[model samples]
Structures are given as C-alpha cells and as structure tokens.
Target: MYSSPEQGGLLLSSLCLLSSLLLNTPLCYGGKILVYPVEGSHWVNMKVLIEELYDRGHNITVVRTSTSPYIAEKSPMYTSITIQNDIVFHDFFDSFIEMQIKAQREGASALTFLKLTKDFLSMIGEAHYLSCKVVSQMLDDKEQVKRLQEAEYDLLLTDPAITVGLVLARYLNLPVVLNVRWIASGEGHFAIAPSPLSYIPVSGSGFTDKMTFIQRIQNMLFKSIIMFQQNFVVGPIYEAMCTKYFKDGCDIISLLQEADIWLMRSDFVFDFPRPTMPNVVYIGGFQCKPAQPLPADLEEFVQGAGEHGVVIMSLGTLVNKLPADMTDQIASVFAKLPQKVIWRHLGKPPSTLGNNTLLVNWMPQKDLLGHPQTRAFVAHGGTNGIQEAIYHGTPVLGIPLFFDQYDNLLRLQERGAAKILELAKVNGPSFEQALNQVLTQTSYRENIQRLSSLHRDQPIKPMDSALFWLEYVIRHRGASHLRTSANRMPWYSYHSVDVFLLLLAAGGSVLLTTGLLIRFFWRTCQNSKNKIKKH
Candidate 1:
C-alpha cells in the first residue's frame, strides 16, 4: 500500500518477465494415438495407460479384432476400428489350460511336458498367424490404408506379444511405443536387451540369476526353446507377411527392438537385476492405486472375519477353473481355515464347498488386495496380479498354472515374499498347509512390505514416468537418439564376432611372418659356416 514509484516499476517489470516466460513455454495440444493392444490380462494393464493418456487430453483409437475377448468394441476410453479375424484369446487358452490340467492330473511325464510345450507353441503360432492376417487384410484394403495414412498418428501404442502390431506400426510409418513384456518369440528383454545367460535366467529355465555349472548348461538348453519359437514357429509367419507387404522384408525381433520407447511391464524389484536399455521405461505397477471403498456386502463379509481377516484368490483371466478334484480339494481346505475365503471360481460349485467360503464369478482384485482386513492372496502368478500384490504388500500363496506364471512366482519365492504350490502338489493338506504358511508366517508379510517400500520409493510415479516418456517420443517425433543402432546391425556385428575374427587374423599373420624370418636367417648362417669350412 505504501510502495514507492521505483518499487512499483520493478514489480511491473517482474510481472512482464513472468508472463513472457509462460508464453514462451508452449503448451501441448494433445496428440492422436493409435493403440493396438493384446487382449485378456495384457489388456488390463494397457488400458490403464490408455486411460491416463485420455485424461492427459490425448485422442485414442484402438485396433480390435471382431473376435477379441477382453478388448470391447465400444468404450469411452477409445474409438475402436474392428477387423474380422479368427479366435485369438479365450478358446485357444481355455483348451490349452484344459490339456495341461488333464495331463498333470494323470501325472505329468517327460513326454507330457514336451507335448505341453508343443501345444503351447502351436497356440502362439496360430495367434500370430491370425493377427498377421488381420493386419494383412487391413493393408489389402487400399481405402483403409489411405485413411490410416491420413490420420497422421503421433505414435503407435502396442504390445509386441502380438507381432502384427509391430508389422502394422512399420507399414504405417509410425513411431511405436511398446507396452511389452512378452513378444511372440519369448520374453521381451531377450529381444531388445543384453540378457547374458550366465547371470540372467531364461524364461522357463527354473534357475535363478545365481547358477551352478550344470544349471548354466541347463539354462542354455532352455534358451533354445525361445530360439525354436522365433526361428521355426512364429518367425516364418511374420517374415512371409513382411516380405509381401514391404519390399525389404523385416523380422519381428528387429522391428520390436527398433521401437521409439518400451513401457516395460516390470521393474528390478519384481525382476532379476539384468541389463536394460535407455528406452525401457519401468511401469511395473502403474495400474495399481490405493484401495477404494469396498461394496457394502463385500465389506460386511470381510468384516465378519474380525481379527482373523480374509484371504482372496483368483486364477486370473486365462484359465476359467482348475480340475474339479483340485477345486474340491481347495474348497475343503478353505473350510478348515479360520479366516474367511473369497475365491473367483467359474466351475461348478464344489461338492465339498463350506459355508465359510464365498465363490464369485469376478472380484475387485486390486481393491481386495489393498484392504486392511485382507491377509494373504492366492493367485495364479500373472504379471499384473503379482505386481498389484507387490504394490499392496500382499504376500502370495502362488498356484502357478502355465506360461510365465512359474517364473513370476519364482522371483517372489526367492525374495521370501511367496510360496509356490504346483498343480501337481495341490492336495487338501498341501493347499491348507501352503495357505496357513503364508497367512501365519510373519516373514512373508515383512518381506513383501519391505519390497513395497522399495517399489514406492521412486522419484516419480510410474504412470507419470510412462506418460512423460511417451509424450517425449511425441515431442521429438521418435526416440531414435535414445535407441541403439545395434537393432540394425547384423548378427555377426551385433555380437562382435566380426571384430573377434579380425583381431585373430591379424595376430595369426604376424606370428607366421616372424617364423619365416627366423628360418631364413638360420639357413643363411649355416651356408656361411659351410663356406668357411671349405676355405
């Protein structure tokens, strides 16, 4: 109120400077993003990113197959472009899970495991073939291709689990951001990162980062399964499509490795400490949040447990239910537990079902995990579920069914945060025993709570980090500066086999020339000695 003229002028100048700085910064007028997501539980996490992007004012268009299971055609989050295609998610996985259950129930043999691997590979091959067909068909329609080209998308968001997304991103000439954990061949890191077999375990090898000599040999053999899938099963399908679509053919691995950014589905907390690249943004529990209020009835049910608390279980979206006998056995074990149990079971109600257990077709899994009254989680070890459990500090009693489930749970077991009960090992007593161990043992909760603290102790939230990097790509047009040129290098050059051979040849030549010079000098000395003797 009592400012002098000089002070008033100074204040006016500061205001002008602040206004100019604000104007010069430039605002982001939200971008148009094209998303081609993998269905099922993969969709669960990818949808979180899409939702956040929408909130940030970006326009999202999703590519969906008519037969897609998890990704619906209509949603407020995105406008979908549907392509008619073959069965991709549910039927294939359901039948495969059924086969595994039957074989294991009868006692799994070596051949049974082999046959399981073959069937699993076949299912993957067919999924890739069908998705490639979807993209190929879209490309065949000149009008659709012209429309997509005109859209001028800022970048493509996709999961490389479906190889067609990589091919489509290439054909459309869009900068890609992959929501990737699994590619068609194997785990995503094997394609894009430096994964040394000596320390980094292969996908299904049943070995940790610390390995003995025999384990290392076994790890190499397990790695061959990935190579087999890439070279023989999924590779040919995508290679043929690439040849027909692009004049210079492409392979899926190279296409994937060339992405603008990778929103890796895991962090070092959940994964082994292996080598990663600059482009990989760890958004392991990006979908997780603090618990919201539970429904009245569910809360009431949970409250009924009082001091005992509750235990929650889900087999994830892939498998509907376990074998009936196993289901009954699990039900019987739940009957004996003091805590109330809520299980997501799709099969017929077990004959041994008890009054204490509540069976639901679906449950708010993350919310339940975050609930204070919830004690332990019985999960099938999907990446999404595992990450949520880690975020909520929920110790898991894992029932690993198939795919990477065992590997995901293995990490928890090593950390002392979980205990694995194989399908083969799930009798009434064993089920009850494992559940009791996770619930009663203090170490399980303590260890997971510690992991939770470590995971949450980040400079920035994972979702925000993911969004910043994605928009970083959009702002820069592509993140080529961050991506390595190794993606384009040949196998020999990428692995430095050429450099090794060059050094070896140079040393070999030098040694040979030196040997020749020594031999000639000796011969000359002998001739001189003979001449002197004759003289």
Candidate 2:
C-alpha cells in the first residue's frame, strides 16, 4: 500500500525529532537566565538584550539595586530582585562630574589627565568593592542562598565591570557570559584577546591605530600602566571581595577566564584591526534603532531652521554640570551660528544664551541625530553618543573630556567623520570653524554615511547575533570548545616569550663556545711558532 504525502512528511519530521532527542542536543530550548547589569547608562545597553531574550520565551530574573530600579515589571517573562540599602550610584556620578569639571578648570595637561584617570579608576575600584559587599550580604543570608540555589538558573549573564555576578555564578557553579559595554579596556590581558601595542591603542591613550615609533613606545608604556592598574589596583579589591563573599579563595581573573562568552560593545567597522578569539562577539549598535518621531517642540525647533539646519549638543548623563567659563565659550559659538542649536544643558543656563540656541535639561538625542535637519553633533565623545552619531550618519565635532572619550574621538577623526576640539582651547573661532568644516565638508558626511551602511549591513542585527550566541552557549553547556588554549596559559607562554628567551640563551652559549675554541687554537699556533723561532 502507498503511503500518503502527509504521512511521509509526518514520518520524516518524527525521525528528525527522535534523532535530536537521541543525540541529547538542547536545540536552543529556552531556560532560566539570570542577569546582573551594571548601574547607570550601561543598563540601557543590557536592557535591550534582556528584553529580546525574554521575547523569545526565556524566563529572566534581573538583580538590580535601589539605584537602578526595575522598569520592566510589567513584562510577564521578566522579574527582578531589588537589593535595598544599596549605595545609590548617583552620588558617585555627582562626585565624578565634580572631578571632571575641576580637571577641566585646572587646564589639565596630559600628565594631569593620566593622574585624574588613575584616581577615577581607583575610586571605581572602591565602589566595586562596596557593591560586592552589599551583594555578598544578601547572598550570605541562608534563605537567599537557598532560594538562588533552588532556582537552578541555566545561564548567568552580567557585565564584566560588576563582579557580584561573577561571584554569584561561582557560588552556584553556573556558566557566565560577560557583556562589556565599552571599548575593550585593560589591554585584553585578562580576556586572552590579542592586544598588540603596535596597533591596539589603550582605552585612554589618545592615539590612533597608525602610530609613529614614539607613539608606539607611548602606547606600550600606557599598556604597562593599564596592566599595573588592573593587577595592583583593581585586582586586589576584587580578590578581597571575592574571598570574603565566597570563602573559596577565588580569584576574579580566573573567573573572567572561564567565562563562556564576551559580548563586547564594539564593532570592527569603527575600531582598528585586532585579533580576537571565538568567544569574543562584537555587538555594537545593539541598542541603536531607527529613530522615533521627535517631540513637537523639538521638531519645530529643528525644522524651523530651514536650510541652516540644527546642531545637537550633549555631553552624556555622567557629566551633568559644566564649568561656567567653558559654558560661556560654547554658548558664544552657538550664538553666532545661523543653525539652530539644541543643547542638553544641566544646572543653570548660561547667561550668554542666544536666541538661536535652545537649552533643555534633556532632549531626544538619537531622534535628533537621525533627523534630516541635524547639520552637526557636538558631543563629549562618549561611546554611546559616538555610535549613535555614526549610526545616523551625522558628522561630529568632538570635545572629549575623560576616560575613553579621547580614544573614541581619535578613532572617529581617523575615519574622517569627526574633529577633536580640546576643551581647554574652546574658543569661538575654533569651535565655529570646526563646526563649519563638518557641516560644509562633503567628505565627513560621505565617510560617516559609508560607515553607517557598513554598520547596518549585517547578516543579522547585532541583537539577534548576540541572542543566537547566548542560546548557543546554553545549548552546548558553556560552549567550552570556543575558548582558546591561550586563555589558560601564562602570559609569557601565551606570547611565546619564554621560548624566545630559551632560543636566545642557546644561541649565546653556542657563540661563546665557538669563540673560546677559536682563541685556543690561535694561542696553540702562536706558542708553536715561538718554539720554532727559539730552536
């Protein structure tokens, strides 16, 4: 008897299902995912990825603090455990703003910038310790530990900057995926990614990918300084916290090495070429989307400029305050521009505010960038702002302040999409010239637009690529096969420096022995010739 086509299709489908089950493949089957995001704007990036996962039918539990309240409580697939009595990050942010403004006022030189950066990083290390302490207290509670243990989470997702998640994963013996929200920092030493000082500029080095001999030397020194900070400064703080919390004498470095994947917030289109392992996934622009409609007032202000267009100026959330003199200088430039200006100002408005300038506490930044009338972007060179500007093909006049801002702008300048205006030298003429150059020059717009196309022309959206990798890790149980052997090797061994030294020693010994034999033979011949002369 002939089987019907429906029966044949059903039989084939059953066979495939049975084969998958027999092989014990997880097949992206959804499971519990626990996420611990770093506080502040960093959360904005993490929220997008988490929501995507939740939409895919995965149960997600986010651990947040009072400082970062759960905003997705309405979602059925998402829940949060808020840690009360936590140190609000806003205080730290305010202190940071004070430090930055003070540095700017003091006319910080390169040396001063390095000093300030070291101090800032040191302060962050202390805060990381405090955050870990609070989380440890909660985790140490017997009831809480029992609840977490019973939860049986299949995967742990967290930002590498926050060590509490690493600690929790260790405590519960779960696999982890680290989401790094900025350019790769700390020399990639801990991450086992190849960071050649010859090309890869350190986070705050203020150097582009193409370096002169002296710049390469400077880059190497900066890398050494970064390593020192990570090991001597940040390492100890994390170690102490991990030891106290887990009581297992765990090292944070080891935990980082064992992470299943690293979702970096960087794209190769904007960054220089560098070697990366399979575990490193570039997910830049994951938070970026097609711009939404602007508010009515914003639309009117932008559209009202006609052909002159408008300029959007923002220095990001962390820098809520600016020095008065600098503000005046900026305002003076804006006043002369025919273009309408939308500035994201903080504290008090500048006395020099002009009729063409519109100052608001907050504006729709991405939407404005995407608007056709946006002639230029004046940014502090934060990664998010730079990425958004690039995504929307807007040219930028970058006034970098601290941390990675210099490096970020340097990369954009190298790509012909931006120009860096030193904050200390923000005069009206220079600012106007720089803004005019970007707005009038066809090259800047063309270059940035080209990059925007490259950024957007991906096989899959960055968010989807990230989600696929996340599920791939879950399906394969930590995906240990993707990890490189270099991750487990010593620094010297990984770089083959030990082998080089061994070869050098062997060659030196052989050369020394050959020299000695030649001298001995020469001495013997001289002695025989002297004896012959005496006879």
**Top TM-score prediction, candidate number:** 1
Which tens-of-lDDT digit does each residue in 1-535 have in candidate 1?
5279999888989999999999997466799999988888889898999999999999999999898878889999789999987655688778988888787777878898799899989998988887887888999999999999999999999998887887888999999999988888778888878889999999888788999999999999889988999999999998899999999898878788779899998999999998888888898899999999999999999999999999999999888878788899999999888899999999799999888899999999999999999999999999999999999999999988888899999999999999999888889998988999999999999999999999999999999889998898888889988887777788999989999999999999899889899989999999999999999
- Give the number of colliding residue pairs in candidate 2: 0
- For 1-535, candidate 2 gives per-residue lDDT tens digits of 3279888888889999999898985467777898887866677678878878988888899887755542444456578877766576677767876777677767968898777867787776777777777678777689988988899999899987766688788888888888884422353333567667787777767888789999999988887777676677667866876767666686656778778888888888888887888888888888788899998878988889999999999998777778887788789889988999999998888888999999999888889999999988999987788889889999999998776788888888999999999877777678888888998899999999998999999988888779888998787768778887776788799779999999999999999999999999999999999999999
The TM-score, computed over Cα atoms with residue i paired to residue i, of candidate 1 is 0.95
In model 1, how many backbone clashes occur? 0
Clash pairs (backbone) in predicted model 1: none
- Model 1 stretches with alpha carbons more than 4 Å out: 1-26, 85-88
Please give the lDDT score at residue 329 for candidate 1.
90
Q: How high is the CA lDDT of each candidate model?
A: 0.90, 0.81
